[model samples]
Target chain A: MPTREINGQSIEFDNEGFMTDRTAWNRDIAAVLAKEEGIETLTDRHFDVIDFMRKEVEEKGTAPSIRRLNKLNVVPTKELYQLFPGGPAKKAAKIAGLKKPEGCI
Target chain B: MKKLLILGAGTAGTIMVNKLAPVLDQSEWQITIVDHHETHYYQPGFLFIPFGIYTKKDVIKPKRDFFPTGVEVIFSGIDIIEPEKNQVKLTDGKVLSYDYLVIATGSQIKPEETEGLVGDGWRKNIFDFYTIDGACALAHFLKYWEGGRMVLNVVEMPIKCPVAPLEFEYLAEWWLTEQGLRDKVEIEFVTPLPGAFTKPKASQLFGDFLDKKNIKLTPEFSTGRVDAANNKIISWDEQDIAYDLLVTVPTNMGDDAIARSGLGDELNFIPTDKETLQSKAHENIFVIGDATDLPSSKAGSVAHFQADILYENLLSAMEGRPLRAQFDGHANCYIESGFGKGILIDFNYDTEPLPGKFPLPGIGPFSLLEETKMNHYGKMMFRWMYWNLLLKGAELPIESQMMMAGKRV
Candidate 1:
C-alpha cells in the first residue's frame, strides 16, 4: 500500500489504487481538489458528484463515463470539465483512488 | 415571414432559442426572443453560491452570448400579451406581432408577500439563495459568522428546486464540522411540506439523514411573518422559531408580466394543458418551465424535457395539425447529503421517487433513494453539461420521456 498526506490527513491507497479507507479518501482528496479550485469549502452539494463517482467506481469496478455520469447527475458537461479537467474518468478515479479505467485516456 | 416570438429569455426561453434557432429555416421563419435582463444565470448554481461552493462568475453569462446570431434577442420588459391580436407589447412602447408565440417567461421570488420578511433583516440577517445578489450577500455574511443556530426556511412550495434547501443544510453541516463549529451550529430545516422531500420513500430516507445530522425538522410550517429585529420566524399557527440567521426560499410566483397580461393565476403562473404544454387560455400560445401552474417541479431538467415535447407540438401547431407530443411531468433531482455522498430521485406527476438503479435497470452505475459517492459526482458534473449541451438543446443520449428503466416500481 502507498500512502499520501493531503491537507495533513494520511490517505492510504492499495496497489490497485482503491483507497483503503473511502471516508479518508473523500475528506483528503476533496480538500486537495477544493484547494486546487480555490474553493474555501466543500459543500454537500459539491460532494454530490464526488460521491456519485465513487459509487460508480465501486459498482462497475471502473470509473463511469462522463456522458453516463452527467445523465444520472443532471449537471452540465462543461462544469464537469471544470471540476475534472482531466475528464470524468481520470479525475473521478483519482479522487476515488481507483485506477484509471482502461481505454479512458 | 413567420415570426416565432418568445417571451422572457430565462432558462426555458434561452433553451428554446438555442433549440429552435439553428433548426428553423431562417428564410421562412425569423425567431425573436424577449427578456428584460442582459445576463443569463444558471439558476441551479445559485444554490451553491450562497454556501461558497460557487462564485458569481460560475453562474452567469451574457444572454446574447448563448443565443444564435440569427435569433433576434430583444432586451426589453414585456408589458402585455394580447392573444386575440397575436401580439406582445413591450414596456418600451413597442409592439411585436408574432405568427406563433412561446411564453418561457420564468418565475420570480416574492419575499415581500410574507409579512416582515423584507423588513430590516433582508440581506442582513435574512437572505435568499434564489438570486445571484442574494447568494453572494449570504456568502459574505456566512464568512464572518461563527457557529450559531441557523435556519434554512422555505416560505412555500413549488420553488425552483425542492431539494436545494435540504442540500444547503447538509452542506452547512459539513462546512461547520470542517470549521470545528458543527457541534455549536444548531441547524434546522423549516418547510411547508410535511416530509423532508415531496416523495414519501425518499422523504423517509432524508428524514433519517436529518436526524443523523442533528438538524431539526419543522414540517408543515406555513410561515406568517419574520420578526427580523427579534431574529424569529412565526408560523401561521403562531409557532415561533428563533434563529441567529435565516436563509429563506421566498414565495415563488410567475413573471409579473403574466399577471399584467391577465394570463396568470394568483401566483402569476399561467394555467396550461399539462401534457400538451399549450396555454389553456389560447391554443396558439404555449407555456413551459416555471411560468406554468403545473404540478411538476420548476427545474431545468423539467424545462429540458418540456422543450422536446413543445418543439414537436409547435411544429404541429404551425402546420395546422394536432399536437401529438405529450409531457409526462418527468423530473429528476440530485440531493447532496454532504460528506461526499448524494442521492438521486426520479419521478413524475403521479409517481414518487423510488429506490433503484437509473438508466440501466440491473446494471446501474448510479443508485436511487440511496446515498452514494457516485451520485454525488453526478450532481457536481451536471454544471458542465448545462453549459455545453443541455442549454444548447443538443440531443442527449437520454430520452426526454421518463423511462421505467433503472427504477424500481
Candidate 2:
C-alpha cells in the first residue's frame, strides 16, 4: 500500500495509485490528486464536475458517468472533455476519490 | 504412397485432419498434422473470460483428444516451408518431404508491432483480451477496480474474430451495471473502420445499438502509438483519446514461416485461389482459415465452411479428377450483446449481413441481424459445438454456400 500526504492528511492508494478508501477524500486531497493527474490547477468547472460525482455517489451509490452527466445536461460533451483533457470520467472519479473502473474497455 | 503434411493443428488443421482421415485410405496416404503445442484452446471463449462468464476449465483441452487414430500428430515448431521442393524443415533440424501440404497455421496478435503498447502500461492499465494470459491478467485487475473510462480500440483491420471487441464493450456495459457501476464508467468503442462494423448494413444496425447504449463510437482514427505514461492513444493524424484503461487489438499477422519460405503475401498470409482454396504459388499446396489471404472474414465459421470445400477438392485433386468443389466464403457469427442477449449474422464473400431468418428460408429458430435471447444462447451453446461437432468435422445442418432465400434483397 502506498500513501499520499496532502495538507497534513494521509490518503491510502492501491498498487496502481488509485485511492483505497473513499472516506479519506476531501477538497484539499482532490486538489493534490488532480495536480498529480496532470491538471496543474482546478477551475470552478472542475469542482462542479467533482462535486456532481461526489453527490451522485452519495445519492446513487456510484459516481455518474460522462454519458449520464451529458444526458442530464449537467455537463456538455465538449466541455467535459475540455475539463478533464484525456479521460473525463476516470480523472473526475479519481479526483473525487473513487476506485478505478474494472473490465475490458 | 503419398505424404499429406498439415502444419499447425489448430481449428482449421484439426478439422482438416478429422474430415480427411477416415475418407482417405491410410495405407496409400500418410496424413500427418504438425503443431508446436499440445493444448487446443477454444479461442471464442477467450472473450468471455475477462468478464467472468467463462473460465480456464471451459476453454482448454488436449490436441490429441480430438485427433483421430489414423492421423499422426507431430509436436514441433515449423522452421521453414520449402514449397518449391515440396518439403518442410522443422525447428529440430528434421526434414519431411510431402506430396501435398495444407497450411493451417493461423494469424496471431502482434503487440510488439505497436510502439509503447507492450511497454509501461501493458497488463497494468492497457490490456488485450485476445490471449489466455492477457485475458486472465485483465480478469484479475478488474476484480477490485471500481469504475472509470474504459476504451476498447482496434489498431487495424483483419484481426481474428473482428466483432469480439464490440462484444466486449457490450458485455462491459452489462457487467458494470451488475456491479452497480454503470453510471461510473464511460466506455468508448474505437476503430479504424468508418462505422460500427465492416459490412455496410450491419454497421448501420450496430451503429444504432451503440447510440442506444450510450457507448461513444470513435471510428476512422488510425492509431499511431500508445502514450502509456499519459494514458492516451495518439492517432497518426495527431488526434489523441485518453483512457483510464485501454483495451487494444493489435495488428494480426500470419505465421512467420510463410514469410521465411517466400510463399506468402505482404502480411505473411498464403495467397490462395479464393474459390478453390488452392495455393496460387504451388499446385500441391492449399491453405485454409486465417492463414489464407482470402477476402473472407477471419473466423471459425468461414474455416468450417472452407473445410468442407477443401476436403472434396483435395480428394478430387488426388484422384486425377477435375476439382469441382468451390468455396463461396460463407461466415456465420453470433454477436453477444450482453444482458444475456445476442444477435446473429451470416454472410459470404459478396453479401453483407442482411436482416432475416437463418438456415431456414422463412421459419428459422434463429433470427439474423436482430438481438434475441435465443441468439445469446446460440453463442453460449457454440462452445459445445466447437469442441464436439465443429473440431470433429461433424457436418452442421447449415448449408455450405450462402443462400439468399431468407435474406432481404
Candidate 3:
C-alpha cells in the first residue's frame, strides 16, 4: 500500500490497489488530473468521466481499457489523452489508486 | 386567487412571464415582474459585438417591450424577499405579496472578486464582454487598436455561455486576419477548463480549431490574482501569463437581491431541485436559469427547455395536482468556431455529448461533434428565434426533452 498527496489532498492506495475511499478519491484526484490536463477546475462533464472510470474499475476488477472506454462514450481520444496523458489505464489507475493491470504497460 | 411575483426581468424572468401569462387567466391569478434595469440586451449577441459581427443597436432593446402587455412590469430594485410573510419588499418600500414566487434573477459579473482584475488597466487594457458596457467598450478599444498579444481569459467557471471566451478568441483570429493584422496579434485563449470546452468531444474538436487558427491554448490556469500593473495573470502556481489586452470574464455571481433575500448559496445562486427546479428552501418558490445552483449549462437553451417543464409543473402546483413534468437538464449550445463554421452539442443529465446528427437523425442539416457552415448559420439564426419565438414562449419545432433519437447513445 502506498499514498500520494495531490492538489493538497491525501490519497491512499490499498495493497490490492483500489482507492481506499471512492468519494474522497474524486476530490483528491480531480484537482491533480485537472492540473495535469492544464485546466483550472473540473467541470461536470469531467466528473462524469471520472465517476465512470471509478465505477468501471469497481465493477470489472480492473480499469476499463481504452477500446472499452471509447466505445462506451464519445470522449475523443485527443482530449482523453490530454487528460490522461499516460493513457487511460495508467491515468485511471492513478486516479482510482488501483494497481496497474497486466496488459496496460 | 394566488399571486405570482417574479423577481428580475432577465432571460429567465422574461420567459417565465411569457410562459405563465397566456395560460393563467388574469381574473384568477396576478403576475407581476420587478426589474431595476430598463433595457434587455441580447446577451449572446455580446459575443459577436467585439468582433463587429453585431452592433450595439442590434442587441439593445427596452425590457418593457418584450414583456406581455397584461403582465405588470415594475422597474424597481428588490430590497428583500420576506419569504416567511410571502412578501417581496422593493427598494421604493413597496410590499408585494405572492402565493408562489419564482426567482429568475440571473448572475452578475464581479471582476473585482478577483484581485487586480479591475485595477489600473481595467477597461484600458483589460476588458470584459459579459456586459453591454464592457462589450461596447471593448468594441471601441479594438477599433483603432493595432494588434499585439491579445489574451481572452475566463476567471472562473459556471459563467454565462461557457463557450464565449473561446468564441471571442476564434473571432479575434478571424477579425485580425480580415484586418490584415493576423500576423501582428498573438491570440491566446486562457481557460480553467482542460480543453476548449467543458465536454470532452467538443473540446477535442475545438482544440484542433485553436491549433488551426494558431491561437495559443493555456488550460488549467487557476487565476490567483490579476497583476494589472505588470499586465500579467498570475495563477495559483505563480504561473504568469502576460497579456497586452486582457479580455476577462470575471467571476459571475447570482443577483445581489438573492443575497438580500437570503435565498442563495455562497455564490448567491438558489439551491434548487435538479429535476423539478423547485427552490430547496421554500416549497412555494421555484428557480430557473442562471439563478439556480443546478449542475447545468447556464444558457438560454436550458431555460427554454426548463420553461416547458416549469410551465407544466407550476400549473400542477396551482391546481393542487402532482407535478408531472421533470427536467432532465437538457442543454444544447452552438460553438462558433469562426471562419463561418460552428459546432452544436446536445446533452442532458444522464448523457454526455455524442457525435451524431441532431434534430434529424442521419440526414442532419446540422452535425453534432463536427463543424459545419450550417451550424454557424443556425447559431446566427438563434437571434431571430430568441426575439420572436423563445422570448414569446412560442412552441418551437424542437422537443423540450433531450432526444436520444439523432444521437448514437
> Which candidate gets the maximum TM-score versus the true structure?
3
Off by over 4 Å in 1: A1-105
What is the fnat value (0 to 1) for candidate 2? 0.00
Ranking by TM-score: 3, 2, 1
lDDT (C-alpha) at residue A38 in model 1: 55
Better of 2 and 3 by TM-score: 3
- Residue B182, candidate 2: Cα error in Å is 0.9
Please state the error at residue B82 of candidate 2 in Å: 0.4
- Candidates' RMSD to native: 20.1, 18.3, 9.7
- The DockQ leader among the candidates is 3
For model 3, how does the per-residue alpha-carbon lDDT over B1-409 read when each residue is reduced to its tens digit?
A: 6699998888878988998998899898989999999998889999998888899999988987789878888999989998999999999889999999988888889998788898899899999999988998999999989988998888767788777787888888888888899999998898866678877776787899899989999987756689888899986556789999999988888988888877886578888988888888888999988889787888889888998888888889888898889999898888887789888888877777888998898878789878899999999999999988888888897888988888875
**So what's the TM-score on candidate 3?**
0.82
When summed lDDT is taken over every stretch of 10 residues in candidate 1 chain B, the lowest stretch is: B357-366
lDDT of 2 by residue, B146-211 (tens): 888999999866788888988998888888889888999999999977788988898898888888
lDDT of 3: 0.81
Q: Report the C-alpha lDDT of model 1 over B22-91, residue by residue, as the tens digit.
A: 7789999999999999988988788778668889999888877788889888899999999999999999
Write the candidate numbers in order of decreasing lDDT: 2, 1, 3
Please report, in order, the local distance difference test score of every candidate based on alpha carbons.
0.81, 0.87, 0.81
Between candidates 2 and 3, name the one with more favorable lDDT: 2
